[model samples]
Target: MDDLDLRLIKLTQDGIELVPEPFKKIARELNISEEEVINRINTLIEHGIVRRFGASIGHRALGILFNAMCVWNVPDHRVEEVGAIMAGFDEVSHCYERLRSPDWEYNLYAMVHARTREECERIAHEISLATGISDYTILFSEKEFKKTGVRI
Candidate 1:
């Protein structure tokens, strides 16, 4: 709600360092007390500016070599049910419902990961079967251009 709160949100958008007393380090750099930084973050969340704060681990470091964006043509009536089922899977890291496209009419989107390409395909097939949606597509990432957090 104040300038300090805005600065805290901006700095935190870049992701926090995974170190002991990370907030203390941030406070030192901002010339504020650690408690102030923590309180401000809480306030920001209460204001709906911060959806959630957490760490994102690199999938490669966990031996997850395969990742793909799986899109599904879920019926409008069943979108929520299908999305919840897809998101509940451990392989799915992210899931969302978007507007249907011309080339691809899928509204349900999910990110899947596995150890190999075949594994990824199998998971996609399973999702299709589970959702009872035969029409789907998998767009695998050839290379990662950027994965860093955004700064607002």
Candidate 2:
């Protein structure tokens, strides 16, 4: 990545504009062509400098008010298998395995989003049934304080 590419990364760290021609707008700012802008981004993605280029949806704005993290106390031997099963759910936005602590026995974590708490619980139940790991807990969020794009 050259200076222009670095500048592009800096400009896009937050997110691209919600415009009909966001690349065009970026091109104007950088004094480059729109196609160049897209090519630079594509190059970054192809080289794995940028893992993903996508939108960060506001689920609450879309009537998905209930959000919770479902933590499962999955066995060490089954962490990857169980995590993948939970991650496969459409209701789950993100799921992964983490290091467990002495006080906290849960290792698998999944972020579940729904319109209501009952729906969230329903998804959790389905995950439990699918994984056959019943030792789990669901902690609902009272509010969404922060939702922002990642910095490069």
Candidate 3:
């Protein structure tokens, strides 16, 4: 990655403009051709510097209001297996394995989103049934804060 690559990433950290020629706009700002702008981004991705280049949806704006943090007490021996199983669900947007504390017994966590609380519960139930891990808890979010991705 060169200075131009850094500038390109910084310019797009928020998002590309919703225009027919978003890359063209970016290229104009960076004083480069549109093709060079695209090629640079592609090369960054190919080299693994940029893991993903995609859109971030506003789920709440789309009526996906209910969000639940479903935590599971997965066994140490089966953490990876259970995590993968939970992550496989379409309802789950994020899944992770965290270190458990003395007070907190849950190790696996999954973020499930839905249009309703009942749907979120249903998804959690389906995950429980699929994983055969009944010991779990679902915590719903009362409000959402500003969500942003990492900046360059």
The prediction achieving the highest TM-score against the true structure is 3
For all candidates in order, the CA lDDT equals 0.86, 0.90, 0.93
Q: On a 0 to 100 scale, what is the lDDT of residue 99 in model 2? A: 89
Model 1, runs deviating above 4 Å: 15-21, 28-31
TM-score computed on alpha carbons, candidate 1: 0.83
> lDDT by residue for model 2 over 1-152, one digit each (tens)?
89999999988887788888778878988999999998999999999999878876778789999989999999899888888888899999989888899999999999999999999999999999999999999999977677765665
- lDDT string for model 1 (72-126, tens) is 8888999889998898889998899998778767788999999999999999999
lDDT of 3 at 48: 98
- Global local distance difference test of model 3: 0.93
Candidate 2 wrongly placed segments (more than 4 Å): 18-20
Higher-lDDT candidate of 1 and 3 = 3
lDDT minimum window of 10 residues, candidate 1? 143-152
Better of 1 and 3 by TM-score: 3
lDDT of each residue in 41-142, candidate 3, tens digit only: 999999999988998798989999999999999889999899999889999999999999999999999999999999999999999999999999999999
Ranking by lDDT: 3, 2, 1
CA shift at 6, candidate 1, in angstroms? 1.9
